[model samples]
Each structure stands twice: as structure tokens, then as C-alpha cells.
Target: MGGVLADGDRVKAVVVKSWMASTGGLEVHYQDGLEKGSSLKANAIQQGLEEDVHVSGAQDMETVVHRPAKRSKVQLGSAPPLTDSARLLARRKHCRFWENSGDEMELELLAAVGRNLQPGTDSILLGTDSHTCNAGAFGQFATGIGNTDAGFVLGTGKALLKVPTIIRFVLDGEMPPYLLDLILQIIGEISVSGATYKSMEFVGSTVESLTMEERMTLCNMVIEAGGKNGVVPADETTFKYLEGKTSIDYEPVYSDAQARFFSDYRFDVSKLEPVVAKPHSPDNRALARECKDVKIDRVYIGSCTGGKTEDFLAAAKVFLASGKKVKVPTFLVPATQKVWMDVYSLPVPGSGGKTCSQIFEEAGYDTPASPSCGACLGGPRDTYARMNEPMACVSTTNRNFPGRMGHKEGQIYLASPYTAVASALTGYVTDPRDFLM
Candidate 1:
């Protein structure tokens, strides 16, 4: 599906199954631009196409799925149960809510829904968040759609598209020491917008070797590079990750052996090094060592990119071995509430001792009050340990763009969790190798 086409190109496409329904609401659409055709610009007062379409969006639908089986009578990691207020809203909106399911990010749940739970042909995951591309790791044609597209999708269950040029990354070695760093380095080299409106198809031995979660991490950042989506062909790892998660029968899709591409990138694990994106832009990259002189005011070690177990393992190696307390306020966040639970209760990092959460606490860090998006993408400057004063931060989040985590004035250095935890301990951007045992 990694194809490039003109802006107005159209082809015959069909929606085998329809997902969300935009039955009501303001029927909001854009007021201008490429999406002008999609926008309705309607409000309760205005008479537009919205009223003729029956108003609200995704409200009270039988087909829409709710996550975690609705009001799951379970909780974890000091996380509060689904509040009655939240339940009331979900009930009114008719949207699926994974109340107390310990999932902070909906990507996994959505992936399970689209790829496994209710597998179907010509499936697309329309999400308000940009990370909807995460589903592409399952070899699905997934991407974030603008509000205009949402209006159209709800009406017809189909979308018009400009097929993007596909860029392929072929690797032939074992995984690197810091795969997160590898992705950072690659993106830095390509620079943001290098693949604008293009697709990134990861292939080769190393990609195949990566676990589904790792592969998702690799592809999840494609959007950060200004690509349409990043995907891996369905393989053994895909099947294993989906086993028992879904019983739906569906056909898997893959690229051709001799598939053509707009460009190809080759890399060997032996030669790559850990890297970070300096302030203002993710593409402004440098090795962690190169930016060691940059002092850090705080460290953030969670996000979809950094909150996974694999990411924590790298941080744990550095944190556990150093056996020291952090000098600055460091926010330790797990991508999902389930990840929070696993870190809180389960022993990890191939070492037996305190739980991951306990270790972080002993190291003088606070678990996110709730397993929800905290301090990422410009969270409230006052709460969540967000940086208000002008300071520098070493973060494991996907972006280092101006004011990403907190105050726009704060400088953010985007790096791996390994680098972030180490920098927090040293009170500066310290190299992870200096701390890891």
C-alpha cells in the first residue's frame, strides 16, 4: 500500500466493513484548504449538510467497540477506577471506554480491534490522535485522518487518498544495543519532512527479528519523520503476538519480493550509535555524547516510545547499576496503565529484586499519579512535574519540538530512556554508556 499518487488521484475502493458512525454532533469540518471539501462548518444554528446527515458523530452505535469489556472490576498501580462521571460520559456518548483496564494509550486496544478482534478487508483506523499509525505495524493501511476525512468516513466508510511514495529500510544484522537510538539516528539523518506524504516500509532480518512491540515502536515514529505511515509485513512475530488475542479469520498482506520503492536505506547494527534530537526539531540530531555538555533540568522517561518494557530494561540497566538517586525531578511514566501495573508488581530487567516501580521510587522518582498521558505534548505547565521555568530536559518522548513537554521556552533533548535516566542522575545530558553496568 506504500504508493504515491497525485493530490486529486482517485481509484475504485470499497469499504468491506464500516467502523464508527458520525450520527450526530456539530458535524464539524474545516473552513479551508485541501480538506475544504470535507468541512461542513456547521453548528447548531447554521443549516449545512450536517443537519441533513442526522447530526452527532460516533454516538450510540452498536458496531463501535468498547475496550476492556466495560467497567472491568479491576484496578492497578494506585490508578483510580473509572470514575462515575467518566462512565456517565461514555454511556451518553456511546463510545467504548476501557474503564479501569490499565491502558493509557488506546493504540494497542485499537490495533487489537482492527487487526485481530474484528479483522476485515480494506480496514482503516480513523483516530483523533496522530499515533493511529501504530496499527500499521500489523501490516494494515492505517493513518491519522483530518476532521474533514472523519466526516466523510462516517458517512461512506471510505476515503479518497493520494497514494504516497514508499520508502523502504532494509536491515541485515541483529538488533542494535539501543534500537530506540537507532530510530532516532535514522530520523535525524532523514530530517523531518524527508518522507512527507510517503510510506515507510521496514523490512529485512533485523525488523523480522524484532518483537511486535519493538516493531510498533520502530514504525510509530514514522509520523514524526513526516511520513504517512510505517508498517511491517505480517510474519511469524505478527501471528504470535495476535495469538489468542483474537479469533477472527483474516488474510494477511505483504509487499512483493521485487517490490519497487522511491528510495531504499540500508543499515547494519554493528555501526549504529545512540543518538538524541536536540531542541526545537526532531531532525536536529546528534549522538548523546555530542550533547553531553547540555545540562538537564529534568528527565521524562515515558511516552508511547519510551514506556514499553524494552525501553525500561535499558533504563533499568543504567539505574540499577549506578545505584544512585536522581538529582532532578524525573517523571517515570509507562505508556499504558497495564504497563504501569507490570512495572509496579512484576520483577523485570532479567534481574530479581525490587519491582520496576519500587526501584524507580527508591531511586527518587514518582510514578505517574495515573496511567494516562502526562507531561507529553505540552501537558499543563503547573502539574505533572511539567517544566515552567526556562530549563533543559532530556526526554524519551518522540518530539523535541519547541515546548513539547512543558513551557515552550524549555529546551528539550529527545533521547532514549537509557540516556534520559542517566542524564537525570548526572543532572545533565550524560552518556548512557557511562552509567550502564
Candidate 2:
């Protein structure tokens, strides 16, 4: 009823009637009407409501209604049936809903669909989740939109978007082991709102040498700095990551040699050190060592931004190297089931066949929790690992704003996986160089 009638009267009438029959009356609120009407139409076709009800769009589309008999087993396959033990463990760790979404996190969902879609080409990706910009690592135009736009995309497979001005970041030095520090430096220099409504384009030798995971981490944080999107040009590294993930034919695009930018910044990261964002803001940058005098109540390592398999491996490398148990209660939540399995199955390269889970255990840490967003979203009060009282925490999550991880009065220090693990080992905001070097 809300989308364009793409065909003759028969099809249009069926869609409109099915939507009206599914729900009584019309949705009149401007934004709600746009979304609800489009969604109802989609549901009509997807659920075969057109076959169940026979009515015409011209026949009082606002008045007719139909309600189907309730199914005996509603949402039977919506989520996996976890065992009582599994459910208990998930609750204790505050992880849930992997079965409902198929994938545990939005980043994983992007991988499943846009892994092979080339950027700079005629391809576009729109997600309801803000971090959809993460796919910019593969050189694609990806960004987040509201439910109204999402519903429109659902009804029709196209969307309208304005082109954003670009800001180029030229990174040309040997990168330090702590990648998060680089992003923190940029955010600190530009402040959170500096890139508002602009695309941040990363290039130069350092970006070219980064792994896909590292590139994704950088692009994922663009939204935190008010960026519309972030991009890293597609190269052999991007193509290699796409191999075996998708078979779709896609053409790659690149910037012109004389492409103009709203602004340009250059950084040589060879001398960088681990950094963190203090509580109440992500751009409040401070060197990890500068905050070593600050004690923490816990350490958390999870979320789409910092809970990838590679992130875990970086933490495990610190744990194995230190050969020390965590001084604080360290929590682990992998971002997806695939990453959870990898922590248990994939061996650390120099750990004599030890997996991350084993290394974590040896370092007196709990087994990696089930994969999900967990406490990073500050979900329900009963969420596992959620901070229930005022306390300090060092997390690998990208955000450190007040109440971001649960309690409004709690303090959060955002750091990279390496810095998070190192701080966990010492119960303070310790620099990763203390261990990594």
C-alpha cells in the first residue's frame, strides 16, 4: 500500500488487500505509516496472505481486516533450542539470541552477504545497524539508515542516498602492534564531530599492509567520530579475504589520481603507543601508561568492534607471553559462533598447539563465553557481565561513554585487545608495550 505499484491491477490489488487484511485500518502517522505499510506489504507476500484473502485495493483498503489462526508452534525455528546448561551458561555470561538472528553480530551478517561485493563499483549496502560502515574495509559504499529507509528497502530493493564529501587520511609508517591507538590518535586530533557527514578515506602504505580484520576495526569506528562512512581501497588483501566467501561477479573501483578531498591528514604510526579513551567519551584520549595508576574492577573483551577472532588471538598472545593470571575478573564474549568455535579449535601459532580458550584458562580466565553482543550494548539489567554498580572497567569495546556497558555511574576505559589483556594482567590501565615489547 505504501510502495510503488510495480505491475497491473491484479498484483497491486492483491498486495494492497493482503496488507489491509493483515492489519485493521490504515497506519496514518507519517514515519510509522511509511514503515508499517511497507512492512505489511512485505509480510503479505512472504507469508502468502494474498492467497488466504481475496480483496481488491479499490474496495475500502482502510477498513477490511483479517487475522490468521494462531499456529500451535509459533516461531518454532526462530531460535535454536539450547540445553538448560547452555542457557544457564549464557545467562551467567550475559550472552543470548544467536539462534534468533542466525548470526551473532551485525558484522558477521555483513560478511555473510557483502563479503564479495566490490566497493567503488555500482554496489551499495544499507543496514539498520550503525556499524554497517565496517564493510568499508572492502572498499564499498556501506552506511546505516533508519527503520523507515530499511522498510522501504525491504519493499523495494533500492534506496536514495546523498554523496558525502571525503577526508583522506594518509598513513605511511610501519604500524605498531596496537592498532586501536592509531584510531584513537585520529579521533583525538579531529575530535568526535570533526568528520560529521563526511567520508573518511584511509590510504597509503600502512593501510595497504593491514589485515582485513584490522581494516575492519578502523572502519567500524568511523561512526563514533560522526563520520558518514569510512573506506579503504580494495587491493589484493581485500580480494584474498573475499576468496571462498562468495562467488558473485563484482567489479572494483578506485579514486581518481586527482580526487579532491574536504581535508587531508597524514600520520606516521611507527612511534605510536597503546592509548585509551577515558569515561564519558570515545575521543578523550590518554596513553595507557599515563593511566597505570588507575585501578579497574574488571576487564571485558567483546563486541562487534573488538570481539573478532583476530582480536582474541591478539589477547591470547599477550596471555601466553605473560604466563600470568589476570589480576581482575576478565570476561570474554566472542562476536559470533564461528569466532567462538575458532577460539576453541584454532591453535595459537607459537603456543605449542594451544588454542585461545586453553591459553585463557591457563591464565586463570573463564572459558570464552557464548558469542553475542553481550554487555557491550548495555542490554537488560539481568544481562551477564553487565556492570550493576559503580565501578571501573577496561574494555576492548569501542565505546567508553557513561552507562555504555550497564551502570550509569560506572567508568569505562576503551582500549585495544592487546591493551585490554595487558591491563587485565595488572589490574590497572597498563600499556601493552609492557608485555608486547
Candidate 3:
């Protein structure tokens, strides 16, 4: 079989063709045997027809699969329909320890692969989810790709990528209680296309002070700014988070002192205040306090960006400080089963043995729901806490586009957990300082 495999020019052409084919349902196209013009087309469809293995959320459990049983047509399958031998092989490759229900895809990836990621090595992580860049916080080269690239990687365990220019953002000074505002500030300044197709490397005294979860939060939103990926160099915090998660040996990588960058920007964290992105865009920024008159009917605290354990802890801290009942319908959704367990089990730091669940209940909020993407994705009309009717909401989720949480006219204000919970208590876009002070 004389065909293209490693030649750069040939590979680029093949990749482009494959991407074009993906618009019509094919994820990848590979030619075998004599690879000349018309002859190459014969085996391309057959290659894509073969089984593919993908471990995903429950939402994709009944996804359609192409199989000959229905004339090779796409039809719903309980799993990725595979031949007997393929099924056995997939079973062997599957790791049940990495499986979890009701978790966002990026969260699952971080739990399974981030801890084992080794920088300065050939280790590469790619996924179909745009937020796959969240893994870059581990100091590894990770990025999101279309299904065509994902399929290619699935088959060959390799991908062709161009080196992206780096734009470093150096954060310094005392860290604010709410870090979401920091990212919102960057996106607001750069607009949506400021860092298109480029890597945003974060490094500074403040970044070094962040927890692993906080670092992931910073990297996760890089996609919002049209960044190819975002990275935070691995440090004691990164290693500490990996301690019980993996026993893999790895070397941490850092930018050389003399490294070149496309651009460098710095910010003083102490001068910042909680910020929010108004409805319709993630970069439509405004100070959280400035929006105090923006009455809201709901508040949501969940999603890969905001539904983590630390996110819940922040909300609990706000509620503990306020000591007031919520005036609006507040919804809570943990990002994963681990987070759900933490909400029910882990004690809030200053609450003196009170769990988040207890604090939320005392604040007149409903019990936190099970782990899932929840209303952030604007699921079915029956989705829990979905804004079935047009309403203004303060949410901890990343995006706040129209109809994102459900109703077309529904408004979403993207804020930190503290702001989200505070708004829930006041029925308006209130600042956390009102309570925390």
C-alpha cells in the first residue's frame, strides 16, 4: 500500500480533504492500496465505516452509529457499534476507573489524563470539545480539534499541528477572592479575536499562588478569547493536585528566560473587582457592582467552569457571610460525582463543620442536584433549572449567550460563584462585598 503517511505536504492535503468531508458526516477519510486519484476514493468511505471507540457523557450514550445492519446507514446505537473482535479490543482498552456519570467532558479528561500528563515529552492530548485546552494548565500541550482530527488521532495516535505563537499574560499583586473576574478582564480587553490561533501562557507571582482547580479555570476560558490553547507552568500546586490522582513520573516544563513571545501583558490583581459578562457574549464586561440594578429571576452555579468543588466552596462562603435567604430561584449543579460528594461531605472552611449542602439549605436554596452539565448547555425543556421562560439570571457558567440556559430572551450574566450566590440572595446583580464585608 503505497500512500501518504508522514510527508508534511501530503498530510496537510489529506487533513484538509478530511475536514471538508466531515461537513457531510464523515469524521475522517483514509485511502488504502493504490492511492492514485479516482482509485483512492474507493477505500476512503470504507475506512470511515469502521468502528470508532469514544468514551463520553451519558448524553452521547445512545448516539447514532454507522452499521451494515441498517444498510450502513447511521442509526441510534446503545454504544459505538463494533464488530466482535473490535468490541473485545475496546473493552480491554476501556478503563472503568475513568468512567463517571453526569460529568462534563473536560472535567473527566482532567481527572483521567491531566494528572499523568508529562510536559517536555511527546505526550499530547486532543479532544473534540473546544474546552480541551483546560488540560494545558498541567503544563502539557493540549488543544481541541474537530472530529476529523480526533478520529485521525484515534487511529494513528498522532496528529499534525503547527506551533502557535505565545502571548504571555503576567498576573501579579494580591489575588482577589474571585478569580473569574481576572479572566473576564483579559477577554474584555482582547475582544473575542485577540489571541486567535495563538497560545496564551500565564505566568506570574499570582499564577504561582493559584490552586490547580483555579489554574484550570483560567485555562478553560482561553477558548472564549479564540486562543489555540492556554498554559500555566506546573509547580508545587500542580504536583500537589496530582499526588493522589496519579503516580506517573514526569518532568515539568517552563518557558526559557530568553524565550520570545508574540506579546506580553501584565495586570495588578489587587486593583480588580468582581466582573460579569452581560448577556449575548462572554466579553461584554462590566463590574459586578455596576450591575447591581440588573434584577435577575434566577441564579445558576454549575458547569465545567464553575461547578467544581472550590466553586461550591466559594458559594458557601458567600452564603455563610450573608446569613440571608435567597430571594430568587437558585440552582446548584455539581460538575461531577466527586464534586457532588464534596458538597455533601466537605466542610466549609469558616462554617465550623457545616457542609455546603447545609449552608445552602439554611439559605433557602434547594439541595444541590446530581452531577451533570445542567442548564448551562440549555438541555431539553425538561432539564433541571433550565430557564423555560425568559428571565435574567446570574450564573457561574462560562458563556451567557441568548437562549443558552433555555428561553430565547433569557439573559445570562456570567459571574464568579460569590457573585452568583450573592445575586441569588438579593434577586439582583449584587456584589459579594455586601455580604463578605
Give the poorly placed runs of model 2, Cα more than 4 Å off. Answer: 1-104, 107-109, 112-116, 178-180
Question: Which segments of model 3 are wrong by more than 4 Å?
Answer: 1-97, 101-115
Off by over 4 Å in 1: 1-100, 107-109, 112-121
Q: Tens-digit lDDT track for model 3 on 1-437? A: 34422212121112223432322322323322213222112112223333332222222323333222212222222333333234334444452123223333453246323554665456766767888888888887778899898667656667888889999999999886755567888998887889999999999998998887888788888999999999999888777777776666778878898999999999998888888999889999989889999999989998888888999999999888878999998999988777888999999998999999999999988789987788987989999999999889999888887888999899999998988998998999988888887
| Residue 84 C-alpha lDDT in model 1 | 33
Query: Could you tell which candidate, 1 or 2, scores higher by lDDT?
Result: 2
Candidate 2 residue-wise lDDT at 437 = 76
> What's the residue-level lDDT of 35 in candidate 1?
22
Model 1: per-residue Cα lDDT at residue 300 = 88
Q: Which lDDT values do the candidates have, in the order given? A: 0.67, 0.74, 0.74
Cα lDDT for residue 233, model 3? 90
Prediction-by-prediction clash tally: 16, 3, 0
